[model samples]
Target: MFTSTERIKPDAQTIALYLENVLSHKYQIPTFQRDVVWEKENVKKLWDSIYKFYPLGSILVWKTNTKLESHREIGGIKLADNFHSHEYQYILDGQQRTTFLLTSIYGNKIANKKNFNPTLYIDLTIELTNVTDDISYAKRFLFWDEIDDRDGQIQANTGKKKPLQR
Candidate 1:
């Protein structure tokens, strides 16, 4: 039953490159995949892991000649619907991670949430040089709604007023 199977070498790509593929319609989520439903805290934790150089589990993608209906948008980034390619990579797992990463990097509006901006912002004032493994990342990373705008300066949920430096 597995006669036609072939093992493909695992390829590593930078986060930027992977997202670029997603933007260019090279990577897509199958229509059957569940929508992104990660809460704000989960996203912050994911970023924390990245900031600490912790390994994020591999994102599994299935490349095939078959083209199934895919999502036109992921994490507010619109994909090229008219793209024509001989092969396509459908995300088999890590949909939540992909969506949050895309949304955090490219600030955009998330669907089904009116006036809710999912763009993640980092509190530069936080001293990350001495972060312990048990520390919560909530203070380091925040969503738009989690920020308090006062006097044109963005403050984190902690209410500490730190000057935004560039």
Candidate 2:
């Protein structure tokens, strides 16, 4: 008995992971597509939603074998092909998610200067001690955004100092 297509689970990380891949110059988007540009409010809304575990929305992906040309360098890195054409998917309706994921997580400089890296709020951590307020975190995206929880107790804990606990 089919569940009437209601059994499909919503994947919150789908867009995020896709954006990461794209930003890392893994999957290339169509060159004719316009550059991603969203304001800080939209970005904060997304981050807040994500932090609250709210369902952002479903992203449409068109898995295709049709290869497309890549846009210019994203944050100084030229996206190159790393997989077979059959696995490629054209983003049908998730440009916003793509934008967030590329600029923030990947720390990719925007091709459009008007929107700089406004969406990025990442900080880096090094050697489990250094938080990157004075450093960059492009190679260690996972280590970024870490809060020095101080043993899982948030009470009376001043998280501002302590080097942000990288």
Candidate 3:
């Protein structure tokens, strides 16, 4: 039986490293788990939350000696064939978050809508800050392809509108 003492509070970098080097490449995705389907906005928000040091809830993993058929690739990342071992950590929850973190940080591609994979890019132009009296910070999700079009679209959408008079 598993115990709660195995839980760890690893930092984002450590988590990313573990996913990229150990989990994704070495481990297998259980057959019962669903495919990653997190929206781009959700992924962006997750990154923003991480950037602001917000607490992203812990992920639960099960340690088991039993082996099952595993995924060869996750979120478009290729994995090396790893033989089944005596001990393995099977993810019980938070697969989406973990996949997003890996794809966003390590520059892996995620499946897109048009049968193609696209890389997730964080918009660095907007700065994140905690205003002393304000409750919200600026954050935007923009793909590399959309960066050039954002300004044009912004102007087109906001330029024609006039402020209401008092």
Candidate 3 per-residue lDDT, tens place, 6-114, comes to 4453435456566755444555567688877777667766766776667888766666788776666666676555655788766667778877777665666655444
What C-alpha lDDT, on a 0 to 100 scale, does residue 148 get in candidate 2?
40
Mind giving the per-residue lDDT tens digits that candidate 1 earns over 80-146?
7875689888898888898888888987776655465677888767666454754647777877556
lDDT of 1: 0.77
Which residue segments of model 3 deviate by more than 4 Å?
1-13, 111-118, 128-139, 149-166
Weakest lDDT window of 10 consecutive positions for candidate 3: 154-163
Ordering by TM-score: 1, 3, 2
Runs of candidate 1 exceeding 4 Å displacement: 1-6, 128-131, 149-166
At residue 88, what lDDT does model 1 achieve? 83
Q: Rate the local accuracy (lDDT) of all candidates.
A: 0.77, 0.53, 0.59
Which candidate, 2 or 3, has the higher lDDT?
A: 3
- Model 2 lDDT, full chain set: 0.53
Task: Note the residue pairs that clash in candidate 1.
Answer: none
Residue 135, candidate 1: alpha-carbon lDDT: 67
Candidate 2 accuracy as TM-score: 0.53
Judging by TM-score, tell me the better candidate of 1 and 2: 1
Residue-wise lDDT of candidate 2 within 1-166, one digit each (tens)?
5494654444455655666666555555666666666655566566545544678787765555777665545443466655455567555566666666556665655666543544344323322223323222322222223334567433332445433534
